[model samples]
Target chain A: MIKPWLRIALAGNANVGKSVIFNQLTSLNQIVGNWPGKTVERAEGTLFFKGYTIRIIDLPGIYSLSTFSMDEIVSRDYIAVEKPDIIINVVDASALERNLYFTLQLLELGASIVIDLNQIDFAAKKGIRIDVEKLSEALGVPVVPTVAITGSGINELLSTVITVTSGERKLKPLKVRYGKEIEKRVQAIEKLISTKLPQLCTVYPARWVAIKLLERDTDVAGKLKNYKNGKEILDYAEKLATELEKIHGEPSPVVIASERYGLANKIAKEVTAIEAPPRISLEQKLDAITTHKILGYPILTVAVVSMFALIFVGGNFLSAGLEFLFENLSMFIEWGLSTFLPRIVVDLINNGILAGVVAGITIALPYIVPFYIILALLEDSGYLPRAAFLMDNLMHKIGLHGKAFIPLMLGYGCSVPAALAAG
Target chain B: MQSGSRGSSKRRNPRGIKGVISLISLREGEKGVMAYAVGGFGLVRRLAEMGLTPSVEVKLLRKGPFHGPVQIEVRGVGLALGYDVASKVFVRPLKAKLDD
Candidate 1:
């Protein structure tokens, strides 16, 4: 009963409600796994709608498509190579301009895009009004204003996904105009690529390859160099980039970035208007005490200590319960076998493989489950950054940040199981 | 519109510290708008690509006395950056008005 499936990718910055939207769309139909040999988490889910079986892939949360991190490389490569039928760029309405920067980059790769203008509720509360239709027109993509937490606009987003991918709706993905000098060089490079390495043009947009080449993006360069004449194409791009840098008096990457931001800012201003901002709200008030210069560190200490205590106590409880349950089971087996079986057979079953299995279950699962719960809680509730902000100085003293400390603490907690294994 | 405003403001400042402060210099609870991220070409590009730009607002959530990495909130998201990188990121303290 397997039907042909259309693939959709939900791509967005962290805290922009991408996961919430994914949760709403998939709703317990997700398989949380990891990319092969990568520690980065991957989530895939399936949705059946209107006689079509669509598979949705939630790419890693990333701010940009640059190869500055593994997540970025994984995300961008998937979109480029896999060529998902549609890319739903989940944008934070409250942070429209910054989010749009990523959307624009997606467009450069020539993917069919549907802008999920998420968190409209937060934006409206902050007195930011967006003309959704106007933004859609500006970006040449269907922009759906959504409160993903409540499932608002989810249907519209889905329908748009269907229509756009099915080619029922024809739209032009907006291209960033990086002015004459830069565009000229890009064209020259694109021509070189299309002529010499025409096969690459099929995989990636010729102009994007040219642009990435000029910016010297490592991941793209790595891929390009493996091609038939990628080195010559890269050298040509390097020459053009140097020439542009000479004229601009700044690095080509910087020059390219300024243009992108400049365009994003301009587009944002055109479609947004402010109503009246609300009074100083709950998050700010909480931050005042939890992030205050005097009170922040104390609060940070208590939170971490309490988290450790809770995990230690909870893990110990689970550990003891499992140990007791397994001890009785193991003893019962040994007794049952000893009554009728040979002594050697009974001892081997009791002390060898059974012991190893019993040791693993009792020792590992308890600590691992609780530690993950605390980690996910901190990560999801938006407290890790605050903790990092609070502990930056203290952490820096030990050559780590608050982010690095969390995993290190998890490792230390695992020592509990290691201790049990030793016994 | 943004470029015009920046030009007018720059003309009046001359030598005034119009909006130039390192990311690390920001105190707790103070928010500013990112203006320029200066460093080697690679660093500037990476920072910009990561959403540190002229328009986004950044708030210092926590920091240490000196030579400590700075934690900041930008566009309602948190990020921790080292002292060296933070020092190179120049942000302008938000004025009485909300720019966004």
Candidate 2:
């Protein structure tokens, strides 16, 4: 008898086209549901290969598994507890240095991973040359080049996934070593947490939790509040933090982040190659005007006004055409009703519900669809971040930080999702 | 009272015209003469930092919206303040030509 389905996870940063790759792998065969406890959406799809069904899960986009954000917490929980058979880390080739920061954190989780170097086409056009073989060897994971949007190298990626999932390909672990003091503190905290909360064993690494506690992460402390002797555990952790801070002359989070960055830089230097600096291209010029300190706001205002103007002009014309079509359709429907039914029934069918519903759909389509399309385009183009940066000072004065500006700007498009995002 | 300081002139306007400096001018710390408030609770910290205590002298340059949301040049910088807060800031308007 064939074994059960092998579970695979697709993880990456936002805008890395993880969704596109997920769609490609499992075209129409997918299920969307919330994860067991969290409200975050989870998607699962099946791919049958070599007589075994593989279950693929698309996890939320997270910058790191360090648990600073809610998304990271959810992602870390899933990977640590669920223990998926393989993790396909889809990394953007153009921004490999930043992407590798998360890659190193994921490696420390000690899970099996395959790195998907996505957006090769765009990277190449920008003159970015990647050494995939060297990167794979350095990271100790199979690195596959892919243009997920165009479906290039996806087959190879799938085959590699299959191979890794099947245990035919073994990956050597990437060990990240911190300073002696941190390692010692990590070991102490890991022992305490493991002994105190064995039930949480599947959910979080004791060492990771210890590091977060040492950093004075309130979120983690709150989460572990129910554990036996939680207050004592926290006190001990705080004592350790005080000692470490005295030695390091900085907060624990800063020290740990510095160490992570140092490791990432070292690995990046070994695995990646940077060519001579390229000349400023068209995109850079556009970025300059678009993100200019002085010119950016005016340009943004004009662009927004132009978009509204187009929407108004196009909407009027489209509404007239839609009215004509709907009028003709209404006439056809009336004729059909009159011919097929008695007078009373025909009158009821024509006047009661169908007419109102059709009119509603017609009215909603033009405004709702166009507005949604425009908002989606703005989000996909990554213009929202620039808008946030431009309006940061104004937002900062209003008691909301600059980071909150993105959701507020997006709120202009749709309040529901924007509020959700802000929350 | 004698005006003894160099290049100093003293003139008084109608009573009860004061405002807080919202922004410091681009220039180095020059004593702000007038200011305004832009709404939001966060400005409390900024006002504290800028030494904008009550009973400070302020002159209103421009008022917007229902004769409110006034913009006053304070410490060489322009500040827009709301009407509710501006009413509380009492000022003695400068009678001399302080613009130079």
Candidate 3:
């Protein structure tokens, strides 16, 4: 009998090399498509492990599961609705604290997870140390350290996945405690939602949805509006918020975030060990000059201009080289065609379609490729945010703020993808 | 209630006239009729966060082409605000000080 397929999800923040890890796991066999009705791209691949085919889906990178942004909404919706068997939460080892914020939110979603501590080599080189065993024990999930770029720990990661999927390893869910009033509100709303929205009860934990509703989350509130008891739930949440404000003197959302961060700080201190303060590394020195108030804008302009200048000069040289090669190939093809085909047919193949296609490819590669490479380098080096910060005042004058700069910087690669991202 | 200033008060209304972009063009340090704050992260929000909220004293430093982005000094910070966002921000231009 064929074994049942197990679904796994790889999720993390942007620029954590999740794609690199996905490529390593899937090798040459991967399928890319859009999520239903959304512009976000979805990648699915399969691995044959331990006599069973395990299918892995790479979801979009998101900062938080709070439905503030569209990507966050899509990611949260997928995990809450689809209920994948396991979620591989890939985190950047160097920036564990910020990454752990998302991890805590993921835990709240109630999905089984395996934390993949990626970029261990870089972390070690920078004098950062993490105790994987202790981390796994604390989070109640298997923690695998990986250097996806160099293929380190990949096999062991795969083995861990197999072991966990096959029931060889068991992980208990980690629960976070919100304060007394919030807990009471969560329980009350969960009871009402469970009874009213029976169909969705199995999809997402009612308590999670209830917590979001009490935070005045428009997305969750809108989703629950069709239910018969939606109004009753809203009224109960408002009353609870009023009572809590009287006692606590703050809003529910702020209180919940503070609790989550407090828990994250505790977990971070327990699992990870630091030798000393982060040194003023090369990146910091570069940032000091590039983001400096006096010379910053001039340096940024020079860098951008020089990058474009290099692309233009290199394109001319490459185009000349390719032209010589293509000319010789055309001559060879012409001689062979003359021996077997008519003159008009030969002309059509050589000059009509083939020449035009070759010209298009040549133009696209030398010019477009270098520009894209520079943009990617800037993005990977983490200078784009600094650039946005410097240009914030200028952007505001144009009726947009610095946040819009993120999408504009992305547009350098492809406008279509940038538009989707901006949405 | 000085005798000479009493007649000037009738001619110059304390609540400045609600003129359009013309009022925004006036130099800073001039007294204004009323200043209103635009809420949220709109053009007004960005300017306000930078200490250029409506009703605050403003001086037009430079105006770009054809009612384009205008540079103004507000609370010691120089800012360039777009024409559209600036137009949305309502202000009553204050009268020029006697020393000026």
Poorest 10 consecutive residues by lDDT, candidate 2 chain A: A362-371
| 2 versus 3: better lDDT goes to | 3
Q: Give the candidate order by descending lDDT.
A: 1, 3, 2
Over A1-423, each residue of candidate 2 has an lDDT whose tens digit, in order, gives 876688889998776789999998888899999877777888999988767788899999865665555667778767887899889999988767557767877877767899999998877766678899998988889999999999999989989988887789988857777888888887788798889877765676677778778867777798788876688779989998888879865456655655665666566667656565567798667755665657877977875765565554565567678878877876788898788678888667767666786666555455455655665676777675555556555665688754576456556654654575577
Residue pairs in collision within model 1: none
For each candidate, what is the lDDT?
Answer: 0.80, 0.67, 0.70
Residue-level error in angstroms, candidate 3, position A373: 3.9
lDDT of 3 by residue, A363-390 (tens): 6566656666776787788786666556
Residue-wise lDDT of candidate 1 within A226-323, one digit each (tens)? Answer: 88798899888999999998997667887787678778878888899988967789887885677566777788788778878888899789989988
Please name the candidate that would achieve the greatest DockQ relative to the true structure: 1
Regions of candidate 2 where Cα sits further than 4 Å from its true position: A1-3, A191-206, A217-234, A293-298, A332-342, A380-423, B1-100
User: Candidates' interface RMSDs, in order?
Assistant: 3.0, 15.1, 11.6
lDDT of 1 at A89: 95
Pick out the ten consecutive residues of candidate 1 chain A with the lowest summed lDDT: A414-423
- Weakest ten-residue segment in model 3 chain B by summed lDDT: B1-10
Question: Candidate 2, residues B1-85: lDDT per residue as tens digits?
Answer: 2212221222122222333222221112223343233333334223422223332344444333222244454321244554444
